[model samples]
Target: MEEGKPGAVAKVIRRNPKSGQREFGDLVWGLLPYKTERPTTAVRPIHARAETVQELPMFADAFRSRRAIVPATEYYVRTETDGRAQRYVVTRADGKPMAWAGLWESFVWPGDRVERSYCVITVEANATIAPYHDRMPLILKPEDWPVWLGEAPGDPAILLRMVDPDVIRCEPVAQRRGNR
Candidate 1:
């Protein structure tokens, strides 16, 4: 799913400890299921800061127990220059799809209705993406996917740090296809 928009559904991967297997599920893009009582003006967050996911009230529980990964071939960022907006596509230098770190949660509304949603985790941008935006999604290395999915024992927070800049490359692109 593209950044800055909500309601997009994407495939998410997480570990099923009960079966010792990895499972795939669909999740709505913007997280923290909206409540009927919430003001119409309230905004739902689509991204969680990597540095604070473990402590923020909305993300803490999910950070500990529902970590996930969102696979992507590339991602886009927008930058404004002299009143004009330009888009840039960022991808791995190795030409491989990326596993973006994320968190998921299942919200139970009244009447036992359940909604599963997720938010991409972002950290301070590395050099490759710094010019386009101040933050970028945490892209995990293949070797660390098991750890991020909780298939192995390790600290997710440590894995959330910015990846080395050399692994990523960005290029300016024409206007994106959809309205976004």
Candidate 2:
């Protein structure tokens, strides 16, 4: 997936309120057409900080009602080395897919058109990723999926914790991925 760009679609899994079953679908990368008090406001937030998602005006509503999980085999991060950008690929140490916490929203544009989009939730970096960046996606364990998807009735905030550093592996790679 293209990082930080809008319109890129990704597969996501979310809980269906009516059926109480997990449903899979494609969602646009960035939240858009968000309503604001000012008619000229333009905002497309790509990442929502997990620490304040429950209180942030842009994400609070979705955080409470539309939490989701983004399953992926790996993700990329960039760092500066010798004044040049260096890229790194991060994956689970056990060769398993990871579940990233996310929030989704449906917005209607001016012409009665509707679109659904989502943003990845990020938390402070753990020891493994701190050398590359100060923030990392909030990776949830399989056992915590039910709680995060609201299948169980516990506080979702508790699931925002970072993954254990030992469970993650990072490797430097060629910087040919894309422009940052």
Candidate 3:
């Protein structure tokens, strides 16, 4: 549950500004726009909805051009049953790592103080996740990586609209007293 928590450092894949190539970099798990004054001064958002990523003020610029990918072996989701919370581990059926669609931002201040963070893009839950939650990260297949990362030519909006429900596999996790 603490894997992608805010303030945590995570490996991210985004286009290299200088070389226009894909590069691996570390970024904070929560998004902080350029307007933000400090890392902890704002309640940074960790997820951006697909339906609004392109239109909302918070995500428009990054969604349109600063897209990134978060490669993950698995992610957790939750549901409520009998007034208690149930958790599930979501992964690809083929066991390959998933490329979760994301957006990144960088903030630079005087004296070269720089900070970067990102947020996962969420789309309406597919059949596999509908029973557990209403939203899930926008999972980008390998083929679409280019377009999503701006490494190749293609439409990224089409990807945000929908994802095949059968792509991921989820398994129930046993609950612990203090885990949520």
Candidate 4:
């Protein structure tokens, strides 16, 4: 279990299914396994509401130590306006890829099988992404990558307050992003 928060189990691998000659059913959700105080089942909620990390214990620890940087060429977000959920692609105007703040952990099972999982951290959307949704992934500035993923532990409160707003630029995109 990463930082102690139960992770979402279904994970979408970065590989192209066609290249692997795999069926859609072959996909599996990645959930970080953890040892808890009781008989709690592992669950990968898949979608972590950026606003609720504090209430969820898993992120608390990772937010401090296991934090990571999730690199992305672009990211899809949904916005509801005029009664429809519109899809938006947020990218860098300069065309460079970016990374979102995240936390990761590795879990080993009974047969020496190891599972690595990650969760992107989020917070209230900045001015740029605010119009689209109330929450957005915490996009890390390149300069802060080392700090966010550094070996030293950080104070979650101080780190959470270090988001950069100007790095995100949102654009209207096709509704296909709304699909799972």
Model number with the top lDDT? 3
Which wins on TM-score, candidate 2 or candidate 4? 2
Residues 1-180, model 3: lDDT tens digits: 256687788999999778998999988888888777665567789999999899998899998889999999888888888998778888898888989999999888677888788999999999998898889889998889998998888889988954677788888766322354
- Using TM-score as the measure, the top candidate is 3
Cα lDDT, model 3, residue 51: 92
**What lDDT tens digits, residue by residue, belong to model 4 across residues 1-180?**
442234424232222223532111211223353442231356654345456665577666555455555556777778677898778888876678766666655566668766656676767877888787777767666665545555334444455642456666787785435444
lDDT of 1 by residue, 1-180 (tens): 564368788888877647868899878787764332552343557899988988987788888888889888888888899999888888898999888999877767768877778889999999989988999999999899888888889987789899899999887775435434
* 64-103: candidate 2 lDDT, tens digit per residue: 8899998888888888889998889999999999889998
Q: Against the correct fold, how does model 2 do in TM-score?
A: 0.87
Error of 1 at 166 (Å): 1.7
Clash count, predicted structure 1:
0
User: TM-scores of all models?
Assistant: 0.85, 0.87, 0.90, 0.66
Clashes of each: 0, 0, 0, 14
Instruction: Name every residue pair that clashes in candidate 3.
Output: none
When summed lDDT is taken over every stretch of 10 residues in candidate 1, the lowest stretch is: 33-42
- Give each model's whole-structure lDDT: 0.82, 0.84, 0.86, 0.56
Off by over 4 Å in 3: 37-40, 175-180
Q: Which lDDT value does model 3 have at 5?
A: 81
